[model samples]
Target chain A: MTLQRPVFPLLAFIAATLMAAPLQAREALASWNDGPTRQAIVDFVARVTTTGGPDYVKPEERIAVFDNDGTLWTEQPAYTQLLFALDRVKALAPQHPEWRRKQPFKAALAGDVKALAAGGAKPLMELIATTHAGGGPEDFQALAAEWLAHAENPKFRARYDRLVYQPMLELLDYLRANGFKTYIVSGGGVEFLRAFAERAYGVPPEQIIGSSIVTKFVLVDGKPALRREAKIAFIDDKEGKPVAINAHIGRRPIAAFGNSDGDLEMLQWTTAGAGPRFGLIVHHDDAAREAAYDRASPVGRLARALDEAPQHGWVVVSMKKDWKVVFPETPKP
Target chain B: MTLQRPVFPLLAFIAATLMAAPLQAREALASWNDGPTRQAIVDFVARVTTTGGPDYVKPEERIAVFDNDGTLWTEQPAYTQLLFALDRVKALAPQHPEWRRKQPFKAALAGDVKALAAGGAKPLMELIATTHAGGGPEDFQALAAEWLAHAENPKFRARYDRLVYQPMLELLDYLRANGFKTYIVSGGGVEFLRAFAERAYGVPPEQIIGSSIVTKFVLVDGKPALRREAKIAFIDDKEGKPVAINAHIGRRPIAAFGNSDGDLEMLQWTTAGAGPRFGLIVHHDDAAREAAYDRASPVGRLARALDEAPQHGWVVVSMKKDWKVVFPETPKP
Candidate 1:
């Protein structure tokens, strides 16, 4: 410069900086702390996507499945759906006077968590059937969308939409960016999760495979509609997870992520496939930022799956240690 | 002082010619004669794909459902699957000695087409079950693939893969090229169709929704496998088509193409969706290029749907008039 080196123009410097910005800004899984879990994901994806690599998967075969509840969003303090079910029970209780005196509905109306838990599986199943069926699929979708838009997370004091893990969201985008097709394979109701999955998780309704009640296509007053029936069509959890994945996706996922025992079989099925695969467990250990009760929690119990991860060579993503942030930023009001 | 033009390099000339070749040679639905049926497809696709147009549909919502049998390939000499099923029964007759005496199995084993046809729905269902179940999903897939790869259509003297309509194949590619996600909503066995669908139709396994037998996930020698059962999981036909479309795709298709009465509800459901929709019924009137039967045919009957097409604003693709050719060219040995 002292020897008359040309001085760069300000606009030129800004343009150059802007040109270089995308390279740095392209980093994905940003919420994840620099750790083995994140590194494993990047390495696996890199190997799988690299042309002519031994582990390279065809774009069509690069399927990734994620469990919904505790895995993607919060399920502790009662599964979000269970809370919705209880609320729906109370809402319908006004019409069904006898339900007010019923065990589950009685406990649900009283807002006694312990009593609802004690009311057992029968009552809970009944609540789900009543709330989920007897209406058109569109009607159920509307009900769910309305609830999710307004429903609050009791402990977090935020809406349920705000409770989804930021890291998981980033991971989803990262996988998709790397030619991976992401699917939500959850125990949650298909129509229930389908209502908000596209907006909440960037997954399409068709890609979300979950438990479903029997639904029939009918003509209601000259209008074609799919009316949900009370009978269970499929329960996509545990063993059912892999079955649903096979039935719907028809390809074994190369990568699978989950948070509880319910996902154990899905992870196993995914990893058991020939060639390089990735299995992840989102360990909810952040008691401060979020609820933490592994191996003992009533709602998202991390039992057999957590213990088996090491043997299966799966990365356990520690929510407490590995995440810079939990939920995504709450949108400005 | 000479006025001279520069000579073009041979390679450059060749590259330019190659670039121009597609424009001059390329044509979609070439097997389709220049008619309203072909024009309707082009117009509907253009309207739906044109941005800001009243009929414009977002690429993500541009779902197209197609029937597999007579619509896409030959089904005149009995559905391709039924022939495969009959062959399987004969192959497995040794395992079940009692089948030798049973009415349907005996007929299937003896290669009595007339007897099997007269045996009714019970025998038909039994044949589907036997061929579909009693093996792992992969086993069924391998069996189906092996058969399709080797089996030739006696009348056409061509393999089933070679029997797929050239026009339909072109149509599938055109739809996909226009950002429409093409799906096979078939009455054939799920695994049966899945075997050849990818290569034959350019449709992936996940996009092929068809009749499926119940499958249970089981561990055989520490290997996770899905074992098919005799029970029906779901039938992807008739009214069931709409239900299957909703359950699997979770969206109302904008365009539906079918060849039988079984596809009526699917077409109706597709067209009734409050927007620019297309419904096409392939009326097999070409007894020369292909077998012709509609009202009187037991297989791929086109009575109710064909009669109702005009009322629903659906286009009836007259195979005789519409198709310049029926099947694809036979590959060199």
Candidate 2:
């Protein structure tokens, strides 16, 4: 089949004009307060996007990766996924009787945050594995969506998805407006993240890189289903961040953003690349609005990265000062 | 930073008008000969893209996956990657004196296809592992590009990249023009496909899902590098196609195209979904233009898929009758 030839000149002129509209009227990073942190981001984008400039990167090569949890959304008091897992344990306690007596399960069931934290990563990993498995990918997505819809953060008194940083949303929009493809690289389960990332952040499922469990293709009563297995396939944290980025993205990103040490290596690997690069860390210092434990905190700790940020030319974004407003609906501090 | 309020009415109208141009004058699947096959493709696209229609899929859900090897290009005489591996074995033969005595290596060195085939997938896998590994991803990409630039298909005497099917190229363009995201879900090495898929086929690296090797992130003299390990990570073929699709894309595709049984499950998974779906198999029956081998061929064997096409509603496209031309530059047969 062939299309009728159209009046090319008029259509071409219109497309060209419309294409230039975003460039002329870009309200970029509106939630970011006027400071070195915001300036650094704007400057880096300008340098890379300027045509014929030394640091100019092609649109195809202009890739930006963002760490999700604390970087994009809230990961206070406890990681959101951990909270989900704990809630899941309580919900499923009737089915698994041994969970009522098990250490992590017992702690989870009793809502003892201190005891759950005391057991360390092993118990947290166990909680994740048990809760995030046995269902098909679609089933898991539905389950996560259902929980996320009703679940509220105790401190914020709002749904977890509603707690996404307004500054980060603007940053994402700003980068995309400048022709940079933004991807979410998180330490959380990919299935869990996919549930709300699209609607909450505008990041698509294919653009999300996160830790995942082994998902097998099985025939369940003649229907093909991707069964999520109780085994970790990859962990997109620390050094694993760079590894997963390469495995999924196939190229080094020009810019990376994160809030914790889990994202340290990703920042290192991204900024270490030749040519113009950027790495920014979101330092959660807004205790008035959100929890602020960082360096010594078990979840989303920021010790080594905090100390090494300056050396790597990584900008540490002070959440309390740099962001005009934390959440989309939150009053400006 | 805030953008000045601009005159938006004019630009919005222009954008709306341009967006409707493709719907009005879509020159779709030009290289496809007019037949039931072309009609099926066009009809499926129309059904899914029609707004307010019962089968109308959202733009985000209009994902179309394609198998890379036989479906997109000529995998005649031998698969292109296998041929590259054999050539690499020859190129590196001087360094490895022990390969002179090794059965598979000896067979590879002698260009003994029958003997190599007799060794089954093991020797072929070993060849892939040994030849494709031992370098960082960038280095491997460079190596692959260097080889692909020089390597020629013995049958066609054309570079492998140059042998991509014209009809398939048109189909890709058609799908993209109609708001469908096209992805290459291949059994070939992801790195190998990444080397040329972007430039040659317009399919980006992230969108190219395929077999991969384990890659590690480590510091080389304090410089971060992803060290490509010589271990098979995942094979994206047969059932693995759906598995990898779910892992990478996190959703079932609306359309799938392939020329071998390796794509059966992917097609099944796509078409069996509860909506408008399309599955196409390219039957390479034009011996004068391209090689014709189906059920008995060791490489790209098409049997079960061909047998099940009728039941699954997959359109079987005969290269001789349904395609106006084969390769991009090849004259109509």
Candidate 3:
């Protein structure tokens, strides 16, 4: 219960641990091209980790938060969660035959993204409520997992999970190697993220904080289950990001990363704290390799945050120039 | 994420690690008297940890939750957090002149526990809203820390942090040492517990899940800050515990410990999961060492849970018989 921080033996211990696997440790961030952006990340980690330095932070306080959608993986064309809902609408169409005439469900069934967008948040919420609820979380997780297994990104001709940027994966490894506890602070549903984040990003379910629907404990057939409700419990976006961060993490993070304005407040809240801080925005400007819509995009819009990045000292990572690889090497069959 | 469970070299590694500190690891639960309760705990841990055994569990799934108030410390006379709120009323009485006549405030100012209880939950809620809000979490955390530093339990004549049970602390350490992530699931306000739980119990802020007030991000002096609002956001007790667990942790816990009926649903939810699970209830029957009033006690009432523990296959530890020690030895000045 003492307020005393542990001694500086930590730095030596960390150095020795990394040195034990010298080649692997040094080659971290291999997908990141040698440039200012990557160097800035490396420098920040070194600065904060250097024992007895003014910017040094103890390992316990080395918290790093990253947004999930475009920051960790692809969010272009549509959010993967939205795609999952549309697929669910199609799969469950027989159970609810009225969907053939319903505006959202009819559009969703026909794969009409345009019509679904026209209905705005109400129809989207209805889709989410109908598809994502009325079952236990484990049931929903299984559904999501099953979908993710066979679901492919049309443009990449690869599984959606495989589209996770290799550079970002390297960055996650690099930060964790330097003693950072990485957390995914996403606008996506927690249940949706938890289904694949551990295997995809090495972030565990407990470490994944996100927007969620209200869930209630129920006794179904004398067995305990968490029944997902139609109502949204919280939306972890924009200003809600910082609020959720405080509510879930308690401590302010030392680093923040995102791809859109939805993460602006999280960056602001994280960087506004005293001492060493970091904020990075991933810019999707690689059209050939992946979809590059930003400011005008309905999903993962990058506007206000892009304009204010310079003032806030946030590093804007241009995907076209910064990453040597857009995705990991596909495993051979 | 792939559903692939990691192969079990884990048991060998765990055995070697434990052997590295053979004496220390073997005597982990030193404060517990050699009895059925201690044996049950050791056996459950071993059953789940043994490689290739039917009950073997992966390290990632080894989560354990403990109820805070009476489970880990003395909630005698009153819950520590309520006592803190009462003190806050006394401290801030000068600012709120109207509180002199306000029923709850008047009762709080006079330290009239009975009068405050007589007014029921409404008065208690008013006390919480008035004294626990209108400030940033950091500011409130500072207030709680300041109070905790000076506050002492009259019965023990020791600081509140010093009143944490030695047996529970050992249990926390044992779980963590065995790759289990321990979380404090409490009905007490998250902010209040976060201020001291980390230092007192080594459970970090993020790992402490509890009831919370609504918080929003606001700019004070053009800097981001989360202002606590005067509203109850969620109550994490009974059913709420499991609901909060699924929301915050996603995965169901493998082990649960509590001292009251408030934790019954959490125990049920954890035990009902499709795996080997363990639940324990602490029976405060050692009046000579501590206070004893379970079935009828207003604070930390343990009636229903005690009656149902047997059916749920939960071990009920009699404090007088099971524990060889209560609180940890006070540090020398």
lDDT of 3 by residue, A274-323 (tens): 99999999999999888787788777778999998999899999889988
Better of 1 and 2 by lDDT: 2
Query: Model-by-model lDDT, in order?
Result: 0.81, 0.84, 0.84
* Candidate with the greatest DockQ versus the true structure: 2
Candidate 1, overall lDDT?
Answer: 0.81
Checking candidate 1 for backbone clashes, the offending pairs are none
lDDT of 2 by residue, B1-333 (tens): 222233465655655445544432225577778788888888888788777889999989999999998999988777788889999999999999999999678888998876675443456767888888888989998999998888888889988889999889888888887788999999888999999998888998989998888888888898888888878887888999998998889889999999999999999999889889899999989899898889988888899999999998899999999988898875222
lDDT of 1 by residue, A1-333 (tens): 011111334433443333322111126678888878788987888788767888889889999999999899998587787788888887787688987777666777888765554443345556677777899777898999899889897888888877889889889987876668999999888888988899988999889898888888899886777889877777788899999998898889999999988899999999999999999999988999997777867677788998889989999988999999998876423
Number of the top-ranking candidate, with TM-score as the measure:
2
Candidate 1: misplaced stretches above 4 Å? A1-26, A114-125, A330-333, B1-26, B115-122, B330-333
Candidate 1 all-Cα RMSD: 8.9
Tens digits of lDDT, candidate 3, B1-333 = 011222334543443443322123347889898878998988888788777889999888999999998899998777787788899888889999998887778888889886664443455666787789999999999999998898888778988888899999999988876668999999888998999998888999999998888898998987888998888788888889999998888889999999998899999999988879999999999999998878877777888889989988999999999998888886312
Candidate DockQ values, in order, are: 0.19, 0.40, 0.33
Error of 1 at A306 (Å): 1.3
lDDT (Cα, tens digit) per residue for candidate 2, span A1-333: 223333455655655545543332125677788888888988888888778889999988999999998899888767788889988998888899997788778889988876675554456667787888999888998999999988988878888888899989888888887788999998888999999888888899999988888888888897777888878777778998998888788889999999888898999999999999999999988899777878878778789999989899999999899998888975222
CA displacement after TM-score superposition, residue B318 of candidate 1 (Å): 0.6
